[model samples]
Target: MSLKAWAAKHYARRVVQSDARWMAQPHQTQEAVFKKLIRQAKNTAFGKDHDFASIKSPQDFRERVPVRDYEQLRNYVERIVAGEEDVLWPGRPKYFAKTSGTTSGSKFIPITSISMKEQVRASRRALLHYIHESGNTEFVNGKMIFLQGSPVLEKKGGIYYGRLSGISAHYLPAYLQTNRLPSWETNCIEDWETKVDAVVEETIRADMRVIAGIPSWVQMYFERLQSAGSKRVGDLFPNFSLFVYGGVNYEPYRAKFESLIGRSVDSVELFPASEGFFAFQNQQDDPGLLLLLDAGIYYEFIPADQFFDDNPPRLGLEEVVLGKDYALILSTNAGLWGYNIGDTVRFVSKDPYKVVVSGRIKHFISAFGEHVIAKEVEQAIQEGIQAFPARVNEFTVSPQTAPEEGELPYHEWLIEFDQEPEDLKGFAAEMDKSMQEQNSYYKDLIEGKILQPLKITTIQAGGFDAFMKSIGKLGGQNKVKRLANDRSTADPLSAFKTT
Candidate 1:
């Protein structure tokens, strides 16, 4: 280990680790409430899709609609370019979320008014759940912190739709207008530097109570909160009760956030996007049961096994199997009528139709049946280092063929350790062991000698940052992407950048 790195580690251990605060309430299991919630979602969303005629079962609806992916939505977006109001949302949209694109440059997703209302309703339900989880009600007393994309109502230079899909500035909550740090919309820049700076200034100034936004953005906000430590929760906003987040998994991030902030903050999860606010993590135990906003979009699940298969099976709400994985499809108040949002999830156990987020359907490497989902990868890393302690800032895994002929696809991991590993090879093997434990498919593949050996590479601090910069994605919103799933090696740099 470098002397400098070792020194930094000891200092951090004393300051951050020793004083870390973790506050969690046992997740609540409100089966009856959640079942009523899902039923409401069915009636509101499906009711409209069937022309206000009540659809009794998830099976009845599934027979008529076919399963689809994000590509199908992109085609609808193209039609929107042709000046067709018949986009996903029914009436005029609030605006698109303008999410950073994966395949192409950027996608201008449409968010109709009904969709926006449905989405907002989901947010409200999430808030109620947060209150239930935290066992507090301070939100009514203080400013709620909403860390969101601040794109405005300005028209796109080109004919095509830009960030503001169909929404206007009038949609922002009235309380936030005067409360916003930067009074003008001009401060909203696509650049990370200006955006983070402006956002940091706002959090400091507002001393926001109920913090909410994308998990990645919230991570950046917490970093700023750690740096700007003078503002105490009580001093800044006495009523501060919840720290709501969504858009990505929070498991790998939870420990770091606790250490940096030096306090235990409660959180709520929302399922908001350009499409609509469809669900909310209203129950603590039900991290993924998503309380469907009965007022917004109609929700359905397609069996995960049917994905990318010749004959896909679309399951109605009733036909959904408990303790199984499924991909989500939605029909909402927004013009998006029966659209699939390209997200996959699993049912942990259900009475109230509760489930845990398994992982994104597309975001994994299981071609030869290794079956490594995003959550499994995160959990394996956590399990591998339970002995004593080992700090990991970030890690990524890519499936690839060994750098030789006749080689099968192996798991390659690039991790930034807080300190050097005592036995790099052992750590990788230990991680593999953990992988085999959590996922049976991977265990079988490994035992069968089909999947290649697990490979590990150490990196200096800020290795991930350097990689993000190379891809022109600096600061917030840049996520860890699994670049390869098979023998394909289109861009090696896409996996992880090195010195």
Candidate 2:
């Protein structure tokens, strides 16, 4: 083998060894513990349906409450955002988490006292399991990194479609107040650059150890850190113990993160959402533990094909089977019952309900883990095109595969523009480069020859707006859906000429 190839192999083996350090936490009593909470949540939601609130004789919460989408929540969300009380929650909520979903633009979810209590405590409890990764997690008092987005500062105090800004502002520990991000990011300034700068300053000033947030934003933080003369995180915070993240797959960011940080810190996958703090990666090397917020909310898992069913299989805490992929349904303390959050995950084991996010069954690409999820791929494509001088007025990503001539399946981007691409060829090449650099799985897949390289297709201006208009999704709360996994918008790239 060539020396470079041997070195690459050596490095891959080592990283795998490091990743393999994670071990599953034993689930001796977690099922019984979480099930009781599920029963109580059901009782709280609708006074129980067909023994639904019975721990000994459980019921699927779905039978009691039909699934309601955000459209059903339009009035309720407005009321909460307007700072009024409504059926969105049982009572006046304490806070609101503005998270965006695949189909929706901005979701201003209500955070009730009960739901907050459930989410916060469950988040803390999940940390206890993260201790397994630390080799000594209890006493992990060190600098941390929170790679989160700038907070959204709206006068209405309504929840919207961003994650870090409002939620972390309210929940950051008092001890970490000095470490909190500046108010400018959370204020009403509309400039993305200004907001990024404020957060970048806070990250640099704190000498943080534990980093958290979406991988893209975190990478921006690290890039800014490099410009500020701090390349390795070890140089800034030798006491760094953990790197926490969620929102998208981590494999792509791993290499870049490691390269930037210089040392391997325990990476934790926290399954938190605007609605609830779901599951967490408990072990350092292994998959995480789903510490079901036993008290915070009740959960229902519907099979993928049965989502539209009059009688869908809805499994509750005690009854949820292991190794099955299910669409997660939640009934939160904020008064959302039988709410489908639009993410699909599978139970790896259930004594403690260990699970993995399989994919967004609705928003994800149908390809093998190429994972062209809507929001993320859109963002990545945006970032990818930053290197190009062209003004990207519109773009769409769709699944494409080889023709009868026979080639691998891949993702292709059809971008529409105002200014002609300064370097159309360059942008396409750079787009794939940026994506590969960001996701390690994509890199491994590419290296293993699992996928044909991601391809970009450019089109005339106004095309994106035309497409969005066709879908009746024009303007403020609605953006054109990019990164479709199916052949809905255009034919799957099967017939396209291989680039």
Candidate 3:
């Protein structure tokens, strides 16, 4: 091994040991984070307004602060944008991560210096843990690329603002900076197509290893690489061993990715957002992501079923039960208190606190009272693909409440396939059967004649990409909704539908 690789492995050992120590005391670590956050933000505008000074326990904090989404918390965020100090956190944030919000058009999530450090630390720990367990640090000597947004930022009110990925680009550790791919000028290109072309030209001949990004965007990059070089990704970059990804589940994209690469590659799944670095995959063999309890954020869970209740109970880390879905809430040192991020997760393990993101609270179908979630649909499709060999590139599920003349209402699945099954109708039937087995409500609706069996609408190759491009969200952490309660996304997809 090279000197650098040796040093990285040595550091990895220490990081893994340290993580084990804190993870053993999940509740205590969370309590420390909670107390620190409350004490530090006591004098802030939001803290003062919520009476944080008198808050003594988790219940007291919960009673004082209501769970709020981005729109509900905009008043305080607007103050911060207007250059107000101590409005949310202890002082003005170092940067604002700009993201597209559902109800609100754009959101500016504060990234305090402390929160920024925690993000970097958690990311580092995840990587070190991988190295420590696998004893593979040879990739450290080669190029590593994070297929990300532009590193460019817009400065306003003395704070830099950009997409979370772009902001993170500015903070690459000194060791990895030299090995990172895509020239600075190439990264600055505003248009995603132009940027990908530039990236392909720049990194085509480099010794690339360890690619990281959301699966969809990475798929685009891989396609570009394949088209430009006429070689499988594995052949083109033989050193590429680790594929790090987050933002969406990778199972649906796994077959397509393996086809593109011509082989299976080890991967690490992360649970990160502009709000905080929440969790990372600690074991390569495990699907569950290890939640970061000691990482400057206090977590709360509301039962997914009870989330719509007027006063859903906010359960602490210790109170969460295995296999039950919960809407994740966060109170961070970045000054977001009791913030509802909309994503729902299920506890897979409690021994060291690991979770699997189940779905989104708002992104589900209940038009016929079936209440089908993203996880169920994803699993159904995966099982279908497994039973009948096929490779899916992209897909989404939306209720088709109105059909022509004599047709009954049904769930419409719009899928873009890299390799379509020989018996498409049979594939759809298998998927429908899987969904019925998983969700009793969906099954009841189908049996009662309230809804027909799900139908598959094939999207032409590149149709999903075209749709996203048309919406100006083609790249940089943008994701097509896996489940839509309405036709907002489905209507636009009509143009891309294959006969």
Candidate 4:
């Protein structure tokens, strides 16, 4: 091994050894971590308002602070943005990770120094754990490309604002900077088409071993690489071995991605958002991601079935049961107290808690009480594509309300295919069957004729890209919503349909 690879392996080994005991006692570790965070932030306005100084336990914390979404916390966030110190955290946050918003154009999530450290530590530990568990360190010897947003952050209200990936780029460890691909200048290119082309030119001939990004964008890069006369990604960079992806389910894109790479590579999934880095796939055999308990975030879970209740029970790590879907609530060192990040997850294991992200709380279709979620839609699409010779590039579903009386509302799916399916109607039927099998509510709706059969509209190959581009959300951390509760997203997507 090269000196850098040897150093990386050694460091990873040390982290694994140190974290093993804590991982075994996740509940206890989390309790202690939560207490420390409470104590640290007790003097802040939010803490004081929530009676944090007197809160002795998780239950106390929950009772004192109501669960909040981004909209509810916007006032305090605005204060911080307007140069108010100690409004949320100890002082002004070092940066704010910008994300799409419902009311506002964007939401700026504070990233304090402490929170940034936690994010970095969690990411490092995740990578190290993978290396330790897999016993593979050769990839560390070659360049690892992280396809991320622009590294050049926009300064707004005296704080840096950008996507989580861009914010993270500013704090990459010195060791990683040396082996990372794509120069800082290339990363600053704002246009997706232009930037991806530059990325291909810069990294095509390099000894790349690991590529990390959202699967859709990574697939785009791979296509561009192939279009530049490369037969496959492996042909251009034979050493490419690891693919780390998150932000969307990988099942639908797995086959297409493998075909582009020309071989199967080790893959890891991460559950990270603008709020925090929550979990990562630690073992190859395990499909669930191990929850990061000791990270600088205190977690609470509200059962998905009970989430709409006025005062649903918020369960701690010890209270969570296996195989139950829960909406994640977080109290972070970044000054977000009792915050609902809107993602739902299910605990697949309990001993050392491991979870699979189910879907987003808002990203569901319940127009006629079917309550179809992102997971279901993804799985159905995967099953649907199996009935034909094609692969799903991207897709979104929304309710198509009846235009006139007596017309039944139905789910409308706008799909962009990597290869056009031979039998589009058959594909739609398969998807309907899959959904009926997965969700009893959906089955009832279909059988009762309360809802019409799902309507599938096949879009041109790059329809999703065009839709995102039209909305100025074409790349870098902007994901196509898998399921929208309304026609707001679906209507615009329909405009991009292929002739």
lDDT of each: 0.57, 0.58, 0.92, 0.88
User: What does candidate 1's lDDT look like per residue over 1-499, in tens digits?
Assistant: 5443344344444432221221011112222322333344443333344433444444554554455555656766665555555334333344555667667757667655555565554554455445444545545445555554444554332232333312423455564465333344423566765676666666565646666665555666666665665653344454555677766667666656555555667766655556666455655655665535244445667776667788777655556776677787776554454567766667654444555666677777876766577777877777665642466666677776545687766787777665545776777777888888888888888788888667776656666656666667665444666334753322334454445
RMSD of candidate 1 to true structure, Å: 10.5
CA lDDT, candidate 4, residue 290: 87
lDDT of 1: 0.57
Q: Pick the candidate with the highest TM-score.
A: 3
Evaluate candidate 2 by giving its C-alpha RMSD to the native, one decimal: 11.4
Q: Higher-lDDT candidate among 1 and 3?
A: 3
Tens-digit per-residue lDDT, 194-269, candidate 2: 5455556665656465666666556555666677754575576566666767766665356456667787777778
By TM-score, the candidates rank as 3, 4, 1, 2
* Per-model TM against the reference: 0.76, 0.63, 0.99, 0.96
| Model 2 lDDT-worst window of ten | 19-28
Worst 10 residues of 4 by lDDT: 400-409
Off by over 4 Å in 1: 1-64, 73-76, 85-94, 100-105, 154-172, 175-187, 224-241, 404-409, 418-426, 475-478, 482-499
Candidate 3 versus the native: TM-score? 0.99
Candidate order (lDDT):
3, 4, 2, 1
